[model samples]
Target: MLLVCVFGGLGTMVRYIFDVSIRRWWHHAFPLATLLVNVIASFCAGMAAAGYVYHTVDQATSLMFVAGFLGGMSTFSAAVSEMVSLARNRRWWLAFSYALMSMVVPLVCAAAGWGLVAVTR
Candidate 1:
């Protein structure tokens, strides 16, 4: 819907802000920008999903936050970039850890949301 589009735009803007801000502050070897964005967005997504399931949010708000903001904020491209960087550096273990951790954390967050909704309501 229109609301989702608007929020999606906002989310993209927010992601850019976070990306740029972090890159400015911490321009080191590691990819702190992408890691920070993905983790925070995942948390937000979990909270939004819980809120919607528990009826703490209406449909429009759910669409905006869950489907739009979280979608825009989480960056698969960044993850791929990080993996590429690791491969280029020949840090295969670190690259594998990065990939594994990314998958584990998001799944855990989603499960946490689902469990919270089931228990609370």
Candidate 2:
């Protein structure tokens, strides 16, 4: 539990840094930071899942990575918040597109990550 907390803190910090760094360059209205972070987290999650399946990672480690690190790193709520903001601002098309991409892109990224790991073995 303590380790998990520590990992979570670390993940949160990393997420913040990534968000700030990306926002520095991404001055657009879209929430690219959150999306990219979520995508990367999803990909890492897929890798961790595949690692567990291949016995390269144990159950506890998998839990730490998925539930602790990635859990902190991914910001689902922020994504939703951004979507809502977009809608409220009358960018319904962009909001809808963001919502759709937020779901679909991560799934595809996870699958790609999983496939990469599976093929390497």
Candidate 3:
């Protein structure tokens, strides 16, 4: 429990660091910071999953990566919040694209990750 909490806090801090850095760099024209953070987190999550399945890491380590780090890093609420903000601002197309991409791309990425692992293993 304590480990989870500590790792979770670390993950969130990493996320906030990226969020602030990207927002400063890009100035929030869209939710670029959020998207970039999520994507990088997802990729890291994929690598962690792959690492776990290949037995490069044990179950506990896997949980630390997936449940602790990725869980804290890749935020569903942030994506939803951005979408809601878009809708509330009446940017229908942008909102719809964001929503759709959010659903489609991550699934595709996960599948791709799993497939690559399967093929190699």
Q: TM-score winner among the candidates?
A: 2
In model 1, which regions exceed 4 Å deviation?
A: 110-121
Score every model by TM-score.
0.81, 0.97, 0.86
Give the alpha carbon lDDT tens digit for every residue of 26-116 in model 3. Answer: 8643787777767777766776688787897788887877788778878889999999999999999889988887877777776676667
- For all predictions, the C-alpha RMSD in Å is 2.4, 0.7, 1.9
TM-score of 3: 0.86
Candidate 3, residue 49: CA error in Å?
A: 1.9
Stretches of candidate 2 exceeding 4 Å from the true structure: none
* Superior candidate under TM-score, 1 versus 3: 3
Alpha-carbon error at 6 in model 1, in Å?
A: 1.5
Ordered by lDDT, highest first, the candidates read: 2, 1, 3
User: Could you tell me which residue pairs clash in candidate 3?
Assistant: none
RMSD of 3: 1.9
In order, the Cα lDDT scores of the candidates are 0.80, 0.93, 0.79
